[model samples]
Target: MLNNMLVKKAFRIIRRNYGCPGLDGVSIKDIKQNYNYYINKIIDLYNSYTFGRYPVKTTTITDYNNKPRDIFIYCLYDRWIQQILKLQIEEIIENDLKEYVFGYRRKLNIGMLRKYTKSFNSKYILNIDILGFYNHINRDHLNKVLIKNTSISKEFLTRIDLSFSHLSNGLPQGNVLSPILSNYYLAGIDSMFNSKYARFSDDMFFAINDLEEQNDIINKLVPELGKLSLSINFEKVRLFETNSFK
Candidate 1:
């Protein structure tokens, strides 16, 4: 699925989004100036079966909560490769993701999420946010998940791993591939709950018909997530006994 045509498509994606300059300070305009050379360079790297790490640029900004959030940016070629990988990997796994796993996907949105939550109409809504989800991704288990899917090419999987070789753990927060990869990794949560929940990225939530099941759920999740080297951010976890989904 990844080819020269797909590489060109990735370029189109980067340009359409007006991708930001990374730590190297190379912009889309810079690439457009000598577009063919850069395009061939990307092709050459792939043709040689090599994927190299680029310095990630990070800037801290105040999120909506007024808390500092670090946004990561990769070099131009790196972004292109990531976009290419995203497009291919999405084809392999997108349709297979759980119905309530709403995050970073083109087809699902907040309206559908609200409707799903409303359909529950349970007595309690438990909101559980994984702490620094992107930062804490278990690469080994993630690799396992991707590897188990026999349809994905080994070369493709190798390139994806090389893209993140610099990080001992965690996926880069700003990379194009991170969102979908995170979704794939956390699909275990949906399986754990038998899809009785709504998750927007790592913002995990569950609607409970009985308050008694609340503690049981949390207690079970604690150890289950640990199997993947993950832990709940207790500070961000909360339980609401509500009459309605709102």
Candidate 2:
């Protein structure tokens, strides 16, 4: 159950951050003006175990190359709820996550991956990236992962299901909690492979000694990923020999 203290802490985090309005156009200023009322409302919904819907606003921003890119904005209230859940969920699964995963973890980045690569004496590296990673995550697979990894309540599971049902397919991109969820969802892949593997978001690197081993790993991995409704972007898949690494 979400308590007042947790709600308040979540509110503080949301209040400190600057964010655009949701599809409903409820601005941060508006939320600040009626902070207590909104917070209480959110608590009431959470306490009652009711699932609430939030709008996702889509807007285009001009890139440095003068290209327009669409960015989705989630509601502040929704973000506050996510913040609370993220804290609890991460606390439960953080230690269980593999060391190879560097995405979304504190103080872990490409540098760690580089150092890890240096330990590998393999001359062949297989690089794979999942296309539309966030948009392609299987909801059923994610639910199973949460269930297996945590002891969340049935009511809480219902609430989670209700929340995700709004997203027809894949996890929502740009949400604070999505990356953590993505990492957890892919944990199975990490456990299945014995090779020197590293991941940053959906980008995966595998160190193998030869082409035969690379093919063997691919054969084992493809079906596993398929069970979760994930696939590699073959066009982006690269296998190259690096004599310098050996």
Candidate 3:
């Protein structure tokens, strides 16, 4: 019914504009034979309705109010990474430590503190994934890991490994054991800092002295990220030096 209505409208326009049976220097016979032109016009209109919009607005970490990215990150941290970190911290406290033997000399205390710190460090990779959280398959008792139908190619994944030197280089994204590769690149920034920091997706705010270090890390990581089939925006990276942070 809709097709008929559209065809009728097209014919009406052709007839009204060229009642004498010739239009745009073509005869009525030629106009009638121009089926391809009319068909193409209709297909173009259909495409405008389909490819022009999506139900979920897709965006990146830097973009705000884009529901998909926002929801994904929120689910990642609040539901997954946070809990994992809590458990890991508990494990580190429980399994990796021995009773302190401290009531002795200054040199002995310093050496013991260093040994404990290094032991904890050995149990952890110096990196984290920014979007380390994985959603569950469903809100059910089975508790399967959530999967995204990512289009990343196998070749791209291989190249990302090569780029990060098998995750031995670059800053961490957030969760060390998180499956997402992007996290390692982002989380390693803390390696340069002498204190803690916070992050909002890719937007990072850190100590001034550490800003150059962060920039250098990001700069180095950006080129290698093409291995993962990802790109970074240099223009949007903001560097601020402030005395406000305690």
- Per-prediction CA RMSD (Å): 2.2, 3.6, 22.8
State the local distance difference test value for candidate 1: 0.78
lDDT of 2 by residue, 1-246 (tens): 567888887777777764676665666678779878977887877777563377676777773324344556677766767777777677666777888888889889876775686568678778787767778898877887787754665566566665554577788655667878899888889888655888877878888888898788778878988888988888888776745432
Models sorted by lDDT, best on top:
1, 2, 3
- Which is better, 1 or 2, measured by TM-score? 1
Q: Pick the candidate with the highest TM-score.
A: 1
Q: Best candidate per lDDT, number?
A: 1
Model 2 gets an lDDT of: 0.74
Model 2 misplaced stretches (Cα beyond 4 Å): 59-71, 240-246
Query: Which has the higher lDDT value, candidate number 2 or candidate number 3?
Result: 2
Residue 194 in candidate 2, Cα distance off native in Å: 4.0
Mark the regions of model 1 whose C-alpha exceeds 4 Å error after superposition: 62-67, 241-246
- Colliding pairs, model 1: none
Expressed as tens digits, the lDDT of each residue in 70-164 for candidate 1 is 77878887888888888888967886688788777887876677678767777777878777777888898898988889988778888888778
Ranking by TM-score: 1, 2, 3
The models' CA-based lDDT, in order, is 0.78, 0.74, 0.32
